[model samples]
Target: MSMNVQNCPRCGKLFVKGFAETCPACVKDIEAQYVACADYLRQNRKCDLQELHEETEVPMRQIIRFIREGRISIADSPNLTYPCEVCGNPIREHTMCDSCRQRLVRDVNQMMDEGKNNANAEKDAHHFRITDRLKDRH
Candidate 1:
């Protein structure tokens, strides 16, 4: 079967869709940007996100993505930071802050507990003691 071809979101060029989102040319450009950011950070280890962007001429979003992808290590570049996706707090790793991550986990756990309770209730609904049945009729 023929592979699907789509427009490169970055440069609007048509390309056979593969793993990368952008066309090959745009992908090369993105790699160059990453190299620029990595090289700049290697020298200026204490550079924050804004300064990195300014010095490397890389976009802030791309830098943030690199951090999220673990392409850049926060430990190596201690000053680099990006906003937490949920609360917008400055975070060097992961998509959200610790508090937000904990809260999300708590919520998910609660939902799972509730779903289990609901399933138990549903199973119990199909059965009734004779006394309960007599009461229902009354």
Candidate 2:
């Protein structure tokens, strides 16, 4: 018998076995989320499904199903505020799409790198003073 190798759809890891779609890492992550959700419910007694989804990194739909199945309790209060899906930043008025958030993060990181390089060059040139007392000494 011959086994076929396929790349996992989730993590892109190559596997030669059953036709599981996701990679081992992604499977482990899902299991971890299940355990974490269970643990959170047990410890906290009750929590909003949205909050558990955010904290455990689980999907809201899955959490809702878990609640329906008695795996977790649904709080009577309003749903928890989840961060923007893209940048993990708190979303206020407008919904920030994932693509936009990722782009913003990339841009911010690039800007930060540029600023760091500029600061290093300035430091090498002694453009900034560290101590006010040393100004007269130089």
Candidate 3:
């Protein structure tokens, strides 16, 4: 087992880092904030992300993280959205928007196709003929 120690980013306190980035105290605080935010959303289902943050006093980043992590479903809250990881466009559900995702897929497919084409070309070039080298003399 490996033991890890690092300063908590939230509190700047030295702690044994585990699955969470923050220390236990900060994790507890975040849990509290999540609970408060959830409770507020339950009472006011139509509230947007900004209103939720304003009402619960939870940081907008934290709220966005919650949404990204799938802790808070935004099915009823149509206005809730987080920035796409690749393009920074406001989106819900996945890490990237549809256009960015499609572009990534196309790029990956093109790279794979290029790799296959290169392999085929190398295979074709591997064959050598005695006549091919001495074609000018022949």
Candidate 4:
């Protein structure tokens, strides 16, 4: 597959972007952490962030990041909760909660309405003068 050249957020090295956001070195490290976390989850099934970090030797931040990115979900493990990207509200599924999503929709609609209104106002205020030759036409 074709890959875009992108800077690795973790190491600041440029590489061909693929499935993972980080570079190959960082991806390997992340994969190892994921494996450790998954192995612990297999046995514990439902555990809190602190417990998972202690048991698996994976950082709590990475685990939370995984959840937020949808790499790891809480469908079966309902105990996990990540902050909403917009309002910081705890959510189960996507990045933002229902309220934030609705708010974003409203904000976008309001901006669109403002743009339409501005365009109509400009159209209504437009001025033009007919040339003498045009005015002389019967």
Candidate 3, residue 16: the lDDT equals 97
Kindly list the per-residue Cα lDDT of model 1 for residues 29-59, writing each as its tens digit.
Answer: 9899999988888889998998999998889
Which pairs of residues collide in candidate 4? none
lDDT (10s digit) by residue, model 3, range 1-120: 877999999999999988998999999999999999889988888887778989999999999899988889989777777788899888978889999999999999999999999998
Q: How much lDDT does candidate 4 score?
A: 0.82
TM-score of 1: 0.84
> What Cα-based lDDT does every candidate model obtain?
0.90, 0.65, 0.90, 0.82
Model 4 CA lDDT for position 96: 91
Model 4 Cα lDDT, one tens digit per residue, 71-114: 77677776767678789877778789999999899999999999
Clashes of each: 0, 0, 0, 0
Ranking the candidates on TM-score from highest down gives 1, 3, 4, 2
Query: Worst ten-residue run, lDDT, model 2?
Result: 73-82
Give stretches of model 2 more than 4 Å off: 61-138
Candidate 2, 2-89: lDDT as tens digits? 7688887766789764645577777788678779988876666555656677788888766544555555544432343334556766
Provide the TM-score for each candidate, comma-separated: 0.84, 0.41, 0.80, 0.70
Task: Name the top lDDT candidate.
Answer: 3
Order of models, best lDDT first:
3, 1, 4, 2
Candidate 1 displacement at residue 88 in angstroms: 1.3
Error of 1 at 23 (Å): 1.0
Candidate with top TM-score is 1
